[model samples]
Target: MTPGALLDLTDATPDPARMRHERHARLVASMREDGVDALLLLGQANAGYATGVRVPACEQARALHRRPVALVTADGADPHLWTWYPDGAPAGLRADHVHPGLRLEFDADARALVSAVHDVCPTGAVAVDEWTMPLRAAFDHPVGDAGPTIGRAKLQKTADELACMRRAQRINEAAVADVKAMLAPGVRGTDLTARLLERAFALGATGNTVDPIWQVMPSSIASGPHTLTGDVIFPLCTTTEPFARGDVIWVDNGLQFAGYQSDFGHTWIVGGAPDATKRAQCARYRAVVDAVVDAMRPGVTARDLTRVARAVEDGRRTPWLAHFYLGHGAGTESAEAPLVGTDLGDAFDETVVLLPGMVLVLEPVIWDDGHSGFRAEDVVAVTETGAERLSSLDFSDYESTR
Candidate 1:
């Protein structure tokens, strides 16, 4: 068999500090426009985006390729990083390269973080990404009320972010092919999961989720919480119900290498031909994904794309399309904003158009609740004319090798 090569794939490149500076300036303008005094990036993703630091350990898991947080003021002053990680951490190195003027401090101590923010920008209504409490609360203060600032900024993706996302997509595609090649007719999900992990490590991923992609949600089988336990895997192929003549194998896996993630899923048939009903259902789901891609032009909203996906799924009585949202934004984190869900309104919000440089993972699945399911996911970049598929595989012909 051919060995995996240490190939250097080109990634989205941006002047990290310059990007932060521009964002700060935009925030300043936004503050003036919205009448907000300052903004505090409480969520790790937002904070890292602003200041170039990885703060929360949990969020750091996804920070395999990027910084953790950036806190800026309405005036668009130099952002500060809140974290205990020394300057030696990867995030710190990234910050150093891009944001030489950024401030760095630890939030747990309270004195430094709170004092620094107060010293820099004391007055005005503070805005924060309240949804990201896991990384927030580290630097609590008696300042102005924190509003929704980071969420607004995060909803939109810059050119640099899209580039990084494209690289992640390439890495994920390679890892998936490598891992799937190791599977046999009756390979246990646990074993297959480990093989995928091995491939990810070989490809230079900083960190990975303990749970295999096949066992995760929207893929079907509900395995036990913990990762490995004597190989009684629940999702993909099981020891009890190993790959049968016509079993469908869906791999909903992810890879986070160098602080970026590529989350996508694909389906395969066991040894023999796939079931007719399932194949048709997969076809419908694939068409739905295509519809979303076709409608993903600039000036389109999550609502508009979601409508297309929902319409296709509703057209068929398939469970996959109806149960889950079409797709979501991908970057330093696996799941981000601008999601296509039922919560969307009448039309795609022109306010949040599908602009160039935004990287997205389109995952439209059909879940069997307990018995079976099928999914085909791919990472794509929003170009000027339309979206570009980043995966090496032809999503139109996604199939299982085993």
Candidate 2:
């Protein structure tokens, strides 16, 4: 790891309350730029980002039973949070903005919610994080998708948000280290997954602050040829297949703290030592990762990084080793915007300019038809001058004892 990377990980923490206020301010500015009058935040992440209050996991069960929502005006007014029960409001919420009456009756119609919205913001077109048929019917005014607007606002992270994410990454590293320490021949993928979950909680992986939502995403663990074939999809299913002596172990996992997420992966060989061939493959993958990270900086476009990755791959004798795009932005959601790739296809919008305060993961996947696959990921934050690595865990190959 670079000295700059070490400094980035050890930066001073910021006050959470202050951070929330700054984030809200940015959202308000974004709303103004988009000409939105008010925002009706429906997505859980969107609500949490706008207001410091996060809907607890317990209340999530009532999602269908009732609606817990937030309303923030573009004019920089204090946001309003509506929940079914008064107790559902987070302690951090301001007393004035907490409105418990927005809850609907068991058989109540959408008119009740519509009336509540009108009461909050008397008139004007509203932007909704997610639009539902009922919400559309309730509002007589025009409603537009607030996803893009909110997403753009979230692209830049405040100091406090970065601090929480850094902490999450530290906890994630410790948990994954624990699991790596237990890897050996004959160990099953299920065994590693179990240990990962156990260590995650032991190391203060308290899910997200929104409610102790533990490991909502399952660990992705694969061994032997399964690693190379990419047959084991994410959120790996429980499997009893034993790891072999020379098998590669790929563990792609995630953990969250205070609603922020830490997502990364590392590769290891089951035996204590890797042969020359495996060592070379690991070095090749590391070079790809380093190239991508070096290319990440403010003012660089996603296409620019893609071009650099292509150059690196073209220089390699075996260009077919790379199988996926270089990486994507990481934040509130594991995979966010500003994806870096040559052809992201229809799934991702390929055009985006990298900016300071943006966090992204550089994951270059390498695979072969019958051999094993290898990949290492590192999280980086675009800095004013360049890029700083947020994830401190080493991506180099590790050899587990037998």
Candidate 3:
């Protein structure tokens, strides 16, 4: 066993096991409403959210992260966590205290899974994350459509869930600071990213849902978003071409602390005077983001907010340059419902309204060949009056790194 290093930050204790039971009850209630007898969660994030178990199967040792599935057959009955490896541990020591009703059991085939469900649910509607079940395994029984129900539940985060997300944001801010300090000319991209990863663990991050992605594009490389290797790297832009005076460096990364993920992007210039166009561009993006953040309140529609952001962006010289919405909600997933975009339909229902406990990501960016990309992402909580920013880091100045 590789001895784990002691961390300065206290390990996040798992929520009361009862929380899982409560969530299970809620899931089962929803499942029953849909006439489903059992709900099978195959996705790791969903499984972990449902049972607090966070281990991957041996087959998932590659780039893919594996999460064991948990089958909840009844509204209040014990749920079975099926996995080849049952005793694996999670960051919050969730495995140590399984709910009195939730337990892990080994399964070699679909027959065992069917047998287990039959023992409890007997006969009724069955549901599963269709994407996860194999064709052969799915043939064992008929399942109902659970996509909408599960997605809606996942999209609307509870107060306790928002608290966990804030913890993630805190860790993410520190990791970003560490990445910035590691930036310098001549530093290898891999080395820079490695340091950021070290800092993440050192600062008490319980490994991220995804690896910290940092890609340092050399100025020699065209200044384009695609230049990123689709992952985080250090010295954000190549130090080989070391950020020169007046050169713009783009940084895009998602800081995952705890189980939540925060996506943010900003562009910085090595040494340059404020150019009128650059200053205006930065201000435009910031204003749109600010408006969206301020616009969040109970009873407001996500689409309306996106429209507001787009209108603000369109006022600028490059109207359509800023295409997407100002931001989205971040919890177990990076991009979930209540999105500030028009493309999303009832998934971001305005009637749902903002609850005081709801947490969301406020990020808006503008990118054009003539100008660079600039955006700020922060976690915020909805209050009675409006929305309150949760991130403590300074994001006021986005044009320069100093």
Note the clash tally of each candidate.
Answer: 17, 1, 8
CA shift at 109, candidate 2, in angstroms? 6.6
Please, what is the whole-model Cα lDDT of each candidate in the order they appear?
0.57, 0.67, 0.56
Looking at model 2, the pairs that clash are: 228-373
TM-score of 3: 0.76
lDDT of 2: 0.67
Could you give candidate 1's per-residue lDDT for residues 60-171 as a string of tens digits? 4344323334456666555565454555233323353233222323334334445555676676555554423322454454444334445455555666556555566566
Name the top lDDT candidate.
Answer: 2
**TM of each candidate vs. truth:** 0.73, 0.81, 0.76
Predictions ranked by TM-score, top down?
2, 3, 1
Model 1 has an lDDT value of 0.57
